[model samples]
Target: MAKRRALISVSDKTGIVDFARELAGLGVEIISTGGTASLLEREGIPVIGISDVTGFPEILDGRVKTLHPAVHSGLLAIRDNEEHRRTMEELGLGYIDFVIVNLYPFQQTIAKPDVGYEEAVENIDIGGPTMLRSAAKNHAFVTVVVDAADYAGVLQEIKEGGDTTLETRKRLAAKVFRHTAAYDALIGDYLSQQAGEQLPERFTVTYEKIQDLRYGENPHQRAAFYRKPLAGKGDLTTAEQLHGKELSYNNINDANAALAIVKEFDEPAVVAVKHMNPCGVGIGTTVAEAYRKAYESDPTSIFGGIVAANRTVDAETAGMLSELFLEIVLAPDFTPEALGILTRKKNIRLLKLGDWSRAAERKPEWLVTSVAGGMLVQESDVLSVEASELKVVTDRQPTEEELKQLLFGWKVVKHVKSNAIVLAKDNMTIGVGAGQMNRVGAARIAVEQAGDKARGAVLASDAFFPMGDTVELAAKAGITAIIQPGGSIRDEESIAAANANGIAMVFTGVRHFKH
Candidate 1:
């Protein structure tokens, strides 16, 4: 067999120097371009610049360096064809056996606090995707790598067998295609943001294989975790787990939702989530008390819901948690003894997250949602309208106790489906109406569930009332205060009814429609 040629280009220099040095020891000639070539050359390894081999000067502001036929033709040619070799020999093309490349850091660059639009557009790579696609298209003849983590395995296979195995080549080729696809999507998303339109068809989702799960939403369905690859700089996927079982599909969903809900509470808080909705939420003087109140909100729902704590979980609270059944618990820190008790249930997913003490300090711009063949994107509901901002159309202003319960109900209702209603007293939810056909129906169900407890309690509605019917119903159920997003055309009528009935009402000026 003749000596194989490997081309390596990467923006992330992590382990590239060492990987290139080891490839040199394997008698493989290294070809790279631009910064990669310059860096490899600095390490005393003889490297061939892509421009030198292409016989074309790097043009178009360095975008045309590796897009020439010399690079792609060498990568895509069928190695087993006699005519292919004959033509390659005439053109003086290299038999590029391996291509190691990762694309530009467009995600990281755009996430910077001061990144300009032109700067983001410039970070987009043209030649990198060309090389990657060409290499993947000819996976039968070459090996391709898109991840630095695969470097050791690739080197081990090459050293032990003098070539990457056929299976490794196929897998690496798959990674190359996924990499290019995700790259294109990132660019599309960026372009759409500049256009000020939420376009789902503009971007496509492609993910590399992270790990296969034991099962999917159910025990029978197949599942795997294909990370967004690039989410927030230090988002949930970047979370470090000090102790826990491998996260299941439901665990990850519930945990993420639980954290999002608990992050809303500015004070020390704990929330219990089930099926991506908060079954219980509580804010208290201590994390243990918060957890207790949240748990007592509905012990039945808390049985297997994901528990999220904004503060640390200590041994005392950890011991308390051990007494119940829970699918997962996410907190900032856990004392050594707390972890010891928590780990007794091997299947319980335990996670330690960042202290959300700074959650009140940050404000994000947009929230993204995906649909089948469509997407809906909007500004985040981080807007909290102060009481002073509330227009007091009602004759009665809510007392402090009623205000607390109203806000509590408001939080729980936001997580419920549209046309949703929740009734609450104290720190616990007394009743919940979810996925109802109409807002009035949702309200009735909630009041009915609370029964005698409905009197003097507060109610929350996810959307505006079209008329005074909902307020009339809440008055019939003896609700002392009501909270809903006020945007209806009949907002005056509802306000008049609330005032006439002496019901305390507050407008959030923000709607939480969870359809």
Candidate 2:
């Protein structure tokens, strides 16, 4: 029988020397290239260089080494075909039974803060990916390994038997294609950004799986958590879970919503989110007070919600949190006492997100959503209207206190699902109506939730009221002032309604529609 041959080439030399040595001991001829050959030779493992195999020296700074027919024909030729076997013997070409390769660190190089374009471009491996693709394409005969983590398993299988099984080869081939695809995607995305293309002609993103959840939003569904390659600081995807069981899909979703809302405030703030909608939001003198106010805003709705705080959690706040049946609690930091108190509830997931305050200033580059058969991509909704940008379109102007509450309500309403209405007083959201089908329906819900509190509070609508009915509802509920984006054609009718009911209304000239 002909001697089995294996080609090994890698930028990451982890476990390569030992793997090659084991293969050599098993009567397998080892062929390698460049740094891999040097490392193997130093470790007392005999290696046949690419130059020896192809009878041609590496040219173009080693870029043209593995592109030769000698290398690819060995990896791609069919073993079952008599003609191919005859041709291989005629050309003195040997069959490559295995190919172990890993691409250069292009993603890692580009991640550096001071990486130059030339350095990044040079790191994109051409020959390595070509060899891998060739080997993977013929995986019915050849075994290919891309990840260093698979080295031990491949060697173990080879030791147990003379060669790997077809099942193992097929699985390894699938991984190789996925690895190369991600490599190509990284290169394309980086170059597009370097060329100042905000929205690429083709939108492509790669993510690494963080964890597989027990189930999705429901038990019958499957779900996993994936994060972008270069996630920025203060991103929820990068948050550390300090204690408790693994996070469920719903917990992560609601925690993200709560975190986004809490990040909007610079002061000590707490936000409770249920089903991706803010059930309560409050800013207070201390983190404990903020949690108390937020919890009291709608205690029933916040029963099983996720809570996020912009400030570091103290013992007092943790004590208050322990009283509730919450899913998750996220904060920038937690005092030793706070952690001790919260950990008592073993099922509650505690996440300590360092420097979460910075999230308010960090804008995501893109927002992606999945639909029936495709994806929708757009710039993130990072725009927020300042207090100075508010236009008093009503006959009566909002009082200074009313303006403060209106701004607070505006911030909270932006995070609520549409059609959304938020009623706030003293920088605390007393009521929030989210995901209603109509503006009037949302307004009525908020008014009913606030009850007597709506009399002196301000109302913030995510979008303009379609008609005066919503304005009339708020007026009847005794809401003192109203703030909205105000782009509807019937803005005059709503303004007249506010004026007639002695309610001051301000138009922000900006809309925040969250679906």
Candidate 3:
């Protein structure tokens, strides 16, 4: 077997010294760069600096160090190619069998509230990713290690087998590419955000495998779990759960939508979500009343749905909730009797999201999706619109009672699928239209559900109207005022429709489309 040569250069020297020492013990040569070499020298382990082997000093503000052909040609040159061997021999470039690197903390730097734009820009690494891609590209001959957490496992495998197996090498290389991809995305996003560009028109993200789920959306499909950014942040992932079944894909999605809506209310609130859309919502004097009103709002759609509540669940509320067939129920807390009552449903998911109002934890966790041959990532939909943030835009201002219902309608609308319409009054949703193919169809469903009560109720929309039809429907249904994101090209038509009917309208400057 050929002797293994590992090149280790990391901005984060978390476990570099120990890792280098372990490589030395395994008879592997350690080649590193800049601080890594200095650190290993201090640790009394022999580490060759890139300059020593490449015979070129690190110049151009340390940017010219690893960019040399000496490093990359060594990493990329095919080991089995006779012509490649001749070229390497002529230039005297050694093959790199392993590459260990981690990029600068650009994500962490930008996340700091006080960090300046210049500081965030400088934290973007150049040479680290170059070496990582080179090693990762030649996975057949090289093992790329970007995570310090993988160091111990790599060392164990090398010590046992005298070298990393090809399977391990490929897996490690896949991780290296993922690491560098995520690093570049964070930098790209930071620069674009700082420049106030139009969200870069497109966003890309890469994530690491954080876990493997029991199964994907279904047991038939294999699945794994990954985490995006927020490595050191105490996000919702860190929250405590009281009990329930292992969350399924649909359960998590609908639970998040339910939680977002429920958190919008300061008073006791209950929201039920089905197919990632809010099917029922209610706010009341007590948690029990809230749940009961929410269930009554659309009991037909609430079956097998995920439920979220703003207030701690009491025994009375739990008893009422347990009577139904819910997939999940989440609240800030559960009274002893409530937990006892709820735990009887072994397959139900229960979550505890305490005191989100305080934001005592870090920034919210993000949700990411994978598309064909690519992926998409975005911050969790956690923006809470306080009553103070609302802008009453109509000539006829909403009454204090109407404003309260407007906010409640706003929360429920945010959790519904796009083209949504919610008719709500008296702190309970009277009717909701979710996932309709067209906005007018959604309005019809909402009005139909509200029936005669539609007259005097408030309405909210996930997106603005393309025309005046939805506004006319809401006005005909007796909606007091309508709330929407309000950036439509036909804004005047919708506004005129609302004004013509003597209905009030407000602009929230935010759109909530669950789909």
Error of 1 at 164 (Å): 4.5
Q: How many residue pairs clash per model?
A: 0, 0, 0
Alpha-carbon shift of residue 194 in model 3 (angstroms): 1.9
lDDT of 2 at 324: 85
Question: Relative to the unseen true structure, what is the C-alpha lDDT of residue 473 in candidate 2, on a scale of 0 to 100?
Answer: 89
Query: Considering summed lDDT, which 10 consecutive residues are worst modelled in model 3?
Result: 230-239
lDDT of 2 at 488: 92
**Model 3 scores what on Cα lDDT?**
0.82
lDDT by residue for model 3 (73-152), tens: 98999889899999988987788888889887888788797999778777878898999999989988888899998998
TM-score for model 2?
0.95
Backbone clash pairs for candidate 2 read none
Candidate 2 stretches greater than 4 Å from native? 356-361
RMSD of 3: 5.4
Tens digit per residue, CA lDDT, model 1, 329-418: 888778888898898877777787665445542565455587899777676666565556655457888998888888877777877777
Model 1: residues >4 Å from true position, as ranges?
1-3, 13-27, 34-46, 49-52, 55-69, 78-87, 114-122, 149-168, 191-201, 205-210, 335-337, 356-380, 448-452, 465-473, 486-501, 507-510
Q: How does each model score on lDDT?
A: 0.82, 0.91, 0.82
All candidates: TM-score: 0.83, 0.95, 0.75
